[model samples]
Target chain A: DAGITQSPRHKVTETGTPVTLRCHQTENHRYMYWYRQDPGHGLRLIHYSYGVKDTDKGEVSDGYSVSRSKTEDFLLTLESATSSQTSVYFCAISESTGSYEQYFGPGTRLTVT
Target chain B: AQSVTQLDSQVPVFEEAPVELRCNYSSSVSVYLFWYVQYPNQGLQLLLKYLSGSTLVKGINGFEAEFNKSQTSFHLRKPSVHISDTAEYFCAVSEKAGGSYIPTFGRGTSLIVHP
Candidate 1:
């Protein structure tokens, strides 16, 4: 199986608190993405990293920031958590081949009160 | 800016019946299409993808999709579905010509296979 792991499988926090989600990959892929899954919206990309220290925003990047200090780790942080940010966060990785296929992590369920 | 559309939001079928989940896309550039299935409480898994060459692509779990470039559609189909086939299916598109590799996903279609 492809090695992708997301930390804190489930978390419940209050609004205005800061939270961080970690995605670690052992495959050493060059691209990493952060997505939030909701009922009707499917999975929306919040942010993504093409390489270490190289990042970009996605369709729904508000209130979220990401960092890739190492090739195997990508971190997503909510500077100020909001109830609307409550959703299942998934970490995905793809090679630099420019193909669209991605491998996803099990996901981290976050609930903001 | 690419977008994917899953025409049917939900489709219910009896076990062993044939099924189809429609998908369409809008993109200025050529695109690579993909279908992903998410089981209950689990992450999404790649069902199939259409990169290049063949128009019809077969994937695990007896599912297949055909890429119709003229219509900008990639619809998933299964001849005989099992109860375990019930899951949420998403259609995604990424620029085949250029830009970041991030995919644009549709709203998703929920498949219900009842016994």
Candidate 2:
């Protein structure tokens, strides 16, 4: 319960459409991450932000882009949704003062058809 | 770059039975290891992590893991598991620093505990 929440708990979009998933936090953590969970694949990082306006790519960041404009919000966008991008997306936050234990949001299930 | 391997794709056990899930990792530099659990229809939760110091790390739900640097292993273990312990367990590793702390996760092991 780190006060993390993901919007649009579920979504369905056609291929080649733009989709954005939102993550909001209230604990004011310094680090926020975006990850997608696939069957048998565990969780793979898509993007992460260490601070406001500072972000980096992850292993599966090929078609995903992320931006963090405020300390509490991190947004993940799919330029053009594809069938392969359909998965459960999770947002996690870590604090600079704690043991780096990541707290996750419930998740957002996106289906690209 | 770092990678993690979960040897068991699935494990089935009865209540009160001891269980162990094997994990192995590869990294050139010092790395941090972690175990995460994902219940049905939920996000992954950190079970435990090995940052520094102790090789043996205990996490919630009576779960523990031992980091063997020489063997490149951090296997998750429990003396006895309960029905509620059934979930998908993931082994992950991250660089100590420099690489944004983005973790690489294994394929995951599905643990099924029966009564």
* Candidate 1 per-residue lDDT over residues A1-113, each given as its tens digit: 68999999999999999999999999988999999999889899999999999999999999999999999999999999999999999999988635657899999999999
Q: Estimate the lDDT of model 2.
A: 0.91
TM-score between model 2 and native: 0.94
lDDT for B107 in candidate 1 is 94
Give fnat (model 1).
Answer: 0.66
Compared with the true structure, all predictions reach lDDT values of 0.92, 0.91
Query: Which 10 successive residues of model 2 chain A have the least lDDT summed?
Result: A94-103
Residue B110: error of model 1 in Å? 0.7
Tens digits of per-residue lDDT for model 1, B13-103: 9999999999999886778888999999888899999999999999999999999988999999999999999999999988866653568
On residues A6-43, what C-alpha lDDT tens digit does candidate 2 reach at each position?
99999999999999999999999999999998887878
Per-residue alpha-carbon lDDT of candidate 2 for residues B8-50, written as tens digits (9 for 90 to 100): 9999999999999999988867788889999998888889999
- For model 1, the superposed segments whose C-alpha errors exceed 4 Å read B98-100
Give RMSD to native, each candidate: 1.2, 1.8
